[model samples]
Target: MAGIAILLDLWRKNQSFNAGLYSARTYQSTQFFSASAAATAATFAAGSSFASRALFGSQVAYSDAGAALPEDYISNIQSASERVFKNHALQYSTKQYDVQLKPLFSAFELRTFALTSLRSFLMYYLPLLEPRVNMEDDDDSLEDNQEDRHVDLVVPFKKSVIQIIRESTVVTTRRILERIAVHYVSQRMAWKILKDVPQSAARKAGRQMPTLVYIYCVSRTTFRGHMLGVAASWIVQVGIDLYRFFTSGFKTLQEDDDEKQVGVLAQRVSVAAVRCISSLIFASIGAGIGATLIRPSRGQWIGCAVGDLAGPVIVAVIADKYFHVTL
Candidate 1:
């Protein structure tokens, strides 16, 4: 019985040992599987993150590549190009006017010549009508009395006329030239501003609208239609001068002079008429040249019209106030 009991104890011990071993093996397997699963999950997460980063990088690159050019930059480049073109056009136009138009217009030299001739005629003829002073007046008392009397001597009309012509021509020419120079500079500036605006904006504004905008911009600035105004003023002045000179000469011939010689008054009137007419014609020519050369936008035209109308008046005011010119 003791031996059997000892054998039973041994068997129980073996079975207990085996059961503990099986439990430990199952636990180890579970642990191994859990570790593997965790590792796989971690790897997947890492891969996902890497993929996300790569995608983000690609997206950023695409966006950068697709970015549009700056509008202002484009506008600047286009404006620069247009300015270059306009400058060349202006240069060519100037050359054409100087070489071609000036020569053709020279036939109108009569316009100025008539004025000068009339002045010369009046200066030579009018003095005859003045009362002659007797060098033989004998009495000392009478001489002394006459010397004290301020004689209202009539100016020979011819001499007066000539003087008027010379003065008017000088004054008118100076004003016309100044106007031309100012207009040219102003137009150039306006063109630069107009060209500098973006092509996209211009296109969006459409044909008539853009032109109007350009005109408006130029007019508001010092550059609007200034050239045309300058030119027109010159033309008008010249035309009026020529008309007066010729008309005065014809009228002088028709006048009845009681002395049978051209009176001082008649001569003076002729000279004055000639001078006035010549100045007017020269002014007109200058204006015509400006109009031919300056091609402003429609808006510019409106601005030019306003400037043209105002230019002479302003010049006159300046001359009267500062230069002491007879307006």
Candidate 2:
């Protein structure tokens, strides 16, 4: 009976320990669930408060005066954009006129002045110098004397001829520049005229003969005027050189020793020459087509303008493909 009592007591102690452990685990689980529920409730309350504030703020904003007239606001923005575009177009047109047409015109004027001065100098000196003549003595006894005299005359005559050529080159170059400038200016004006007039009216007008005539006349007149100037400048330069050569006793002076500054003068002359010749050739072909066929009607003008702008690009392609030229 004593052994059984002892065994029973041990079993009761084990059962109590197991019950205590289960109770402790149940309490921990319940505490964890309560804390999670409280956290969930707090989160829900915060979310609801945020939603209410956002809804109220939206209502208040809509009720304000600034929130209305969305279409008017969009239309105003569109109208402002259109105005800006129009302003930009006008400014672009003006810039094109100034940059494209004005510089060419100025160059033409300068070329004319230089050519005129050259021609005047030439006319003044040619007759006085009698540059084309070869004087020979008829004294048969002095054969060596006759030969020396002929040589002397030939040298001066040769110099005179060279002077004449140089003068002519300047004149020709000036004429070309002037012609190009005139054509460019007229075309620019034509563009403005078309833009100013109503599109329908301009189309109905078809060919503008008066405008064409104006362009031609201006080109011709400017060319003639500039050519005269170039001729004069050439003659003048020649005269100065001749004067210096004669004064120096027919002795050939070193180019560096000369006060006439031939190198700088030559460079200027070359620039004028290139500008005139290139302008003439380009204008005769390029500008001629642009003004004649392109300027007659609006459609023609548009086509011509596109072609004109694209001309350099076309030439570049040709040069690259055929001539192996590159930039």
Best by lDDT: 2
Give me the displacement of residue 177 in model 2, in angstroms. 11
lDDT of 1 by residue, 87-117 (tens): 6688787421221112222322676656755
**Candidate 1, superposed: residue stretches over 4 Å from native:** 1-233, 253-302
lDDT of 1 at 56: 51
RMSD of 1: 28.1
lDDT value, residue 7 of candidate 2: 45
For all candidates, the clash counts are 32, 18
> Whole-model Cα lDDT per candidate?
0.44, 0.45
TM-score of each: 0.22, 0.26
> Candidate 1 at residue 205, lDDT?
34
